[model samples]
Target: MEGYETGAGTARQAVKMDMPADQPQTPIDEVIRTAYDNIGLERLETVRALVPRVGMGGLSPVLLNKIRPLFKHTHLVKDEYLFQQDDEVDFVYFPENSVISEFQMLADGRTIEVAVTGNESAVGISAVWSTSSAVNCAQVCVGGDAYRIEKDVLERELTYSRPLQRWLHDQINAYIKQISQKVICNTHHAVEERFCTWLLMLQDRSRKNKFNLTQEYIAGVLGVYRPSVTCMAKSLREKNAIDYVRGQIFITDRSKLRKMCCSCYSELPPRRVF
Candidate 1:
């Protein structure tokens, strides 16, 4: 083999590095171009519709433009993980006709939902204060599209926009308040009452009288056994509070449903409060 002698009297063989030609091409400017395309005039109309729902509609034209460039449209599918617990938070999402659920995993492999975010709110709002990770598992509870912005870009803009900062802070406070109240509700409320409360919350967020949700998923969200959830569903059905067929739940009797729920549902702040 052909070799070269070094000054140290060591011989080294010549080598040729082989690289794959089919590797994906990712140019620096490609991201910028894609973002521009995703936020085009047609999409800007969608953003205009969402900004108000997420409580960012009142931003000044200059600020809105600055922030708008940071956002890219996103589609969130059902049962998809936006981010897992303790995962790095690279982006914060603003739901537009979407619902995201936050879940806390227990030591015994069980999980319970701590909160839900919908069209009128933002997901991963805690990213603004945290370092770069999430505290809970975030998933798409309902399939829909949204807008997302990098944490760094949003943080940079937050430092310069007083209105945006204040609005986000208010939203964070509201979220914390919701989680705290759920703690008390789960501790003191009955399973049937809690079940009703959960349905009402889902109804409010989806803005629909009916949605597809199985009893097993409801059990997981409620942090109860499957049998318990089944019993509660049967009870609700018997009381004419709701009609559960297969995986779909229909709120046929809204008044009865509300009456069955604990006061926690009404006591919580409305979705648009922030």
Candidate 2:
């Protein structure tokens, strides 16, 4: 059995840090001011349009316009690290078309995905009240466009906006629910069932039928051996639930895949947190 060793090493090597250690960190206030200055009318409109779509429907237009300047559009790539474990989160990412996965690394160096964040919610929102350092490692699972705001800027806005504060608390509750369910699924479900559930969840977040993911990567995310993923993939293919060639996986039959998935799949919020 090829355990997490090889897969984990590959993930570690593939991680592209947003900020390099050699680069001097800019002051947060200055970064915010610069982003504010660079904000264009079109960009602000784009951000405002995305707000309601991403579960912030209650935010007033006035509030949205006020903070629109604080946002900076960002394009993230696959395998990019938003923030590593124990590192202070400098920005909160709101993925418009991207999917971000948060993993908890074990003492033995193994890791398992605990939560996934996509367009429905933002990542690193816990930085509002939680510790400065991140508890899990966050990485881009599917690459695309996203919007980010400086942590300090978001914190400052939260102080006076009761709606925003309530929304953040609701998001945090949903996050906790997802993580708790993941634990139950990992502990009680079969690998095949879990694989099906994961595929459905990924498809929901990425809004794509096909994904560029390898068996090793799937194994690492599930904390299983590479061969286990291979077997499960083969089984899924035989059932016409999915199809894969090398690093690419395509959902061939959504109905069949859903049938094979565990109850956990139906339990998750629809078109919301994964």
Candidate 3:
């Protein structure tokens, strides 16, 4: 616990080197040392401020204190896969300003995103029900930091904290609702409308107006042809709703995007059973 901090105003501590000065370093150790040298304490504090954005905002102090010990703060890069389908559920991640997409692969090798969860939801909710494997592939669409906890520790804590259990259940229900709505949207909505809805949803989740996403990735998530996504993106750019260059996109006119989106954008309300 020498390099760990648990409090309201402090950032989690970095790893302290206790080995002898002449000790040989492993490849992994060298990488970690480099990372520690590069990431400043101020940046870690900035990340700590975003932790409260995870899940419901009213977590009891007792519950937070109990669970904080199990969390390991780490950064997630864009396009990184947290868990692949059928993989053993080892950890649950609480993202902060990170957009995670749950995608189900089809028989024809195509993938379709079932849900997009941000700070308000935690990935690997299957651990709550004691599931042994991942149901879908969870990938980070927007790069950011997150607190990850081992599934065993999380399960133990969930068993002891009723508030935590209830909160997680509600979050899981909200995620299920998102997947259900997306299913319907993919089936009935036009490609352009669905694209707008997806973009708006990503923006809301990441709380950022700009994104580094390729058209191929967008098409995969939307379950549409890449050419179709290219066309739609171009049209949106022409309408001044967004700006796209290479693989990056920026929302230039949010009002126009809102107008172009279907009612489904706002219809999927976040519900709580607690």
Candidate 4:
């Protein structure tokens, strides 16, 4: 926090971080090292592999080392507030091993997640688009590491670099597809449909059928009571729709799940949720 400048046009407060030779490197250290090795990072090694439907093999190697140097490594523990509502946006983050959720609280005191970003996605669009200071309440749901850059620097790179710009467009398009599907699901699907669709989406991202979860976390995202999440999860399991144990939910019956899920899952053709 000390010896830092908040903003200075395209310029950022730069400082060298020392890795002590005496101390062993942490997991965060390894992620940083691996990121340098693989321009295209595989999803499994990232910390955010806990969630489903978030598997992203990001960046081609040529671009990986090229762009990797532009980013600074950052870490956030679980449940930590990354950015509060109305905070100024300085850095745009591409999470390598973390899951960050963007949500808004309603007047009735309910919170709804607008987007859950990790491997395949980019964050801080409003900063680059609006060029404004204020930001929304985006928190860390899963603890992990990220590559961060100043907003101005990111925009400048996107503007002049055609390859980076194309990559940005592709990433943004993926998110647009997701948000569009979520809208359709929220409006027309039944509760069971919505639940399955959500689970399937999570699975696709995390690249795993089994994941750590709490009923309360599901309830928060679904905008329902904790008990409701438990009951519904129980319902799905009883019907062999899924298997839940020790914070792990496994979908054993994909056939039944797709049947039970709304058209959003099957009809829309998700990117990689199979």
Candidate 5:
């Protein structure tokens, strides 16, 4: 616990590496190397911050301390399924720099992304109030670290904290808005516009301009064919808005990319919730 800081009003300790430092190495660095070398303290700080979507933004420090122990840090890989449709909701995931996509499965074996979650929001939050199975498949679209708390543990904690409960409800409302916008965008916008919007959203969540996304993956998320994604990528590259090589896509000109996006881009949530 040497590299960790105890919350101001609670005995709970959280990783403190997020603090800015002028020196390249300090006493905190030494402690991190000695005590938390294997955990990657920087990545583990996702749970330590008062992130809004994680439902810790406005809670009292004492309440945060009581529920902090319920969370377990996890590293999620791209394309890994956090929970499949119809599966029992076991845990809720709080992505740090990672990105998770909730896909609605169709009977024709197609999957379309309904919502994308990042540090601004959590995944599988519906489980907090319902004991039913998952409705959509939640998968890690970008590989990175996250924190997860068991559904039952979070449910129990919510029962004791009104602030946490209100936070969760707000997150749910935001999530619904996101899904609704996706529906409108998919129905009314062109594929090129939708593609640009999707890329921007991914960049917003992952905090990276370059993404290791294959055309196949993009097609699946957009509910389009591989050839269509290929065509759209080619157009974006020709316009100098983006560049793609093999499985990677790079946002080369953000301004140009934004220009290509439809109205949906502006309708989406801000980069940060709090």
Candidate 6:
């Protein structure tokens, strides 16, 4: 896999170099070059990190070609609010490079994240199940490209595709598990365990062992004070599990962190995603 050459012929060239005359070629041949391949993957790296199947939907050519335009080019600003709690819930978003956070707002004006949306799946589910609004508010965590579709459109077409429906259900199930476990971890676990759990979850969608984060936001997600988060992060770092510096977190040893985390990491909330 030195390169991403997608050739199925005697000879062909990649985006970096063309093949000689006796070669059979396909349009994808050149695009699979190492440099070009990375550009493609980085574009949706966030999405793939979560679902791992965004590029494999394999929709029929007719259907894909028709809907492809809808997603091929879309944009959202960094830190933009996509929607809020109790909105009409008429659409869901498939973010390409962005990270979307779903939170529940408490009466005290604090919010707790229920799920995070990145690649391979839609962010908000309001339109998916025809619910009015389940998200307190969703914001762009990474601020990148996003694909959006009306809820009605996906629902109508979903009836004809079992695979797509199944994928959607899987995403929902993951969301519920995230929210439930986070709630229990927040309520019953010690701060250190909660910090480790948060790191474990974030590790799933980050591009590197080092991540962009802050204790202030972690506190918001956990519905706790900033000092509490700072204390836990410090303890984890002291244990050689992770390090925090200038709004960034570096995971030193994943296995150690997993071991240090609580049992909620093992016991997830039971809910039907679909």
Better of 3 and 4 by lDDT: 3
Give residue 34's lDDT in candidate 6 (0 to 100): 22
lDDT of 2 by residue, 1-274 (tens): 1221221111111112233233248654334323322332224345445544542222355765777788899999998999999999999998876889999988787789998877767899888766669988999988988889998889888998887888788778878888999999999999899888888677666656677787777887899878888788778776767776657777666556667888887666444422
For candidate 3, give the lDDT of residue 212.
83
lDDT of 4 by residue, 213-237 (tens): 6676676677776766777877877
Deviation of model 2 at 151, angstroms: 0.6
lDDT against the true structure, each candidate: 0.68, 0.72, 0.70, 0.60, 0.72, 0.58
**Which stretch of 10 consecutive residues in model 5 shows the poorest summed lDDT?**
1-10
* Tens-digit per-residue lDDT, 1-274, candidate 5: 1111222121122233333435555554243222322222234345335333432322355755777787788999999999999999888888877889999977898789998988777899976788689989999998988888888888888898788888799888888899899989989999899988888777666656678788778888999978888778778776767776656777766656667889887776443522
Q: How would the candidate models be sorted by lDDT, starting from the highest? A: 5, 2, 3, 1, 4, 6
- Candidate 2 versus truth, CA RMSD in Å, comes to 14.4
Q: Tell me, what's the RMSD of every candidate?
A: 21.8, 14.4, 16.4, 15.4, 13.4, 13.2
Between prediction 1 and prediction 2, which has the larger TM-score?
Answer: 2
lDDT of 6 by residue, 244-268 (tens): 5665666666656667878875454
Per-prediction TM-score to the true structure, in the order listed? 0.74, 0.77, 0.76, 0.67, 0.76, 0.65
- Clash pairs, candidate 1, are none
Off by over 4 Å in 4: 1-58, 74-76, 133-136, 245-256, 266-274
**Candidate 5 accuracy as TM-score:** 0.76
Q: Candidate 5 vs candidate 6: which has greater lDDT?
A: 5
The candidate that wins on lDDT is 5
- Show how many residue pairs clash in every candidate, following the order shown: 0, 0, 0, 13, 0, 5
Angstrom error at residue 221, model 1: 0.7
